[model samples]
Target: MAFLTNVNPALAAYLNEADPTLWSRVYCPGDRYNIKTSNIAESINSMLMKAKGYTITYLIEFITKKLGRWYWKRREDALSLITTFSRGVEFLLALREHYADMMTVERIDGWRFYARGGQRDCLVDLEAKSCSCGVFDVEKMPCSHAIKAVKSSGWHMSTVVEAYYRKDYVYASYAATIIPNVEHDPIGPNIRCIPPIPKQKPGRQKKYRWLTWLELSRKNGSKPRKSHKQYMLVQNADSLDILNLIV
Candidate 1:
């Protein structure tokens, strides 16, 4: 109950319950620390550097002309693949769904972090919001530990995606195409064809044939049944063993 009170007051009040361990962890910070910073310019710049390597001019011109359509049409049918690939650092930091194991949510002086008794592998999620791990702001994406937090929250990934991707930026290319339809209407009615409807298949023959059981029997023999036989035999004792026993 105490943990709920600190982690999310609304949840505590709504559920009418408190978590002692959470409260204890929140208040106790003898071991554990928070990470600092929120900008990931370096990381983004790295991505930009790699992406810029592609020769833009050499690629198809349509991409620059109709970016939205190009992106939309090219989006893979594999939704799962895209969702996983698109998960950036932010989602991980905010959610912290990755490291659900060792870290516990601890808040000291209103700052939150998933702290371990010592500090190796521990993470903090802070926008000065809540996190002991400070990787969120530094990289502008979820740190590995932050991804653990997100998974713990039970929130939809789609919501995270919407928050990260800007609306105008994602929609701009699709909205630009405005080519109007300008084809002429109908002209005149045409006559139908009547060339015996083209031969669809060979016609069924009317040749006479026998279908009686005897006729079938004469044509083909019935499957034969196997003979039922069983044999049991008892072997005599080996000569060497019997001779030794007798001696």
Candidate 2:
């Protein structure tokens, strides 16, 4: 924030005015599950890249087929899981458990414990499923401190982990089937359907599509180059002046 204020005070002020919960995971009320990007949307776009020019009906059909295949494959994978939690969660828990083995847990009460490991000491509450490190509370999964406390108290790891990471939940998520509608013969008199004619705008149409930030960065071999308009803007201009120039 300090760096942003120094570089662009207007951008910093705008960000400060907005609710941090909308942008910062630290302030978010709901669980983020460690995800911090729009990779899901990017993945969908990648899948439909070749189908960009397809007509509406064909595009829908293509997407349905693709999703159906994904559902079937994922359902099969979920069925094969013998563990209580998903593979990813199980792997993470196992890794944390290894670290927890090195940590020493001192019972503060029936549910609370003080875990000391390496240079850090953390408070772990088994009943609340939280750790002073903040990882357990945010991830909804036991951190190393919590794991040590759980083991010392002879409590099950499953009791501390959220149900969202369970095999049953994963299986249920992919249980639905995507079925396309079957073609039906028209009973009424056939009427010719035609698309409306497109009216040309006053200006000439663009010859090329605009490149995305990722494309631009890749083309430059690092950061994206500033546009001609951006270069024209005065470097030391105030926020109001910058806005007026942009307008």
Candidate 3:
């Protein structure tokens, strides 16, 4: 944030006005491990840019087919996996282990310890799964300090990592098959059928709502949108659709 303020005051001011937790993934609450940016969303939007021109039924069918293929592929991949943690989390754990090699741990008790790494010292509590650096609490993954403490206590690295990173949990996540939408299913006669609205210009249509300052400025629509409605739509659709599309 300080760097941003030095580079561009306008961008920095906008960032400061927004909730810090929303922008900085490190300080974000909950088990939001390995989720930093919306690159996954951007990738999907880029993939489906051409589908935006298709009619509603065609769009639905296209997406449905894509999803079915992905679900089958991922399910097979997950079933074949032999590793404990998922690939991404495993990489993080390995990286933290490397950092832990340089750190020193002093046990204060069975659950708590003091670890010194890089130029700083932090208190680590294995039972609570936390470190004074705040990374362990927020990311639900062991930092260097926590890793040192875990090693000193003769605990496995997996003992400190969150359950969400477990192979069973990851496999269970992608286990379900996606049934494709029924083809040529006619709409009911009593129900009114509405076609999707057309885009006036050529460009990739965004599936997610714009929240950042630059994105707000790039918005092309003239009419004012209700912020609450837009936010709700983004939360609901983005969460469901993107998970199916990318995962």
Task: Compare the candidates by lDDT and give the number of the best one.
Answer: 2
Report the C-alpha lDDT of model 3 over 123-172, residue by residue, as the tens digit: 99999998899888888889889988888888888888878878788778
- Candidate 2: misplaced stretches above 4 Å? 1-20, 184-196, 199-247
What are the C-alpha RMSDs, in order, of all predicted structures?
24.2, 17.0, 22.3
lDDT of 1 by residue, 1-247 (tens): 6986999989778655555434443343342224323456565455445334344432223233344445555343223333333433335434444445545544432323455542455555443323345444433445445444454555444333324343343344344454322353322123222245565567985688766765566567863244448753436668657766867
Question: TM-scores across all candidates?
Answer: 0.29, 0.68, 0.63
Of the candidates numbered 2 and 3, which has the greater lDDT value?
A: 2
User: Considering TM-score, where higher is better, how would the candidates rank from best to worst?
Assistant: 2, 3, 1
Model-by-model lDDT, in order? 0.45, 0.85, 0.78
Cα-lDDT of candidate 2: 0.85
Better of 1 and 3 by TM-score: 3
* Residue 183 Cα positional deviation in candidate 1, in Å, after optimal superposition: 14
lDDT of 1 at 156: 49
Residue pairs with clashing backbones, model 2: none
Q: Pick the candidate with the highest TM-score.
A: 2
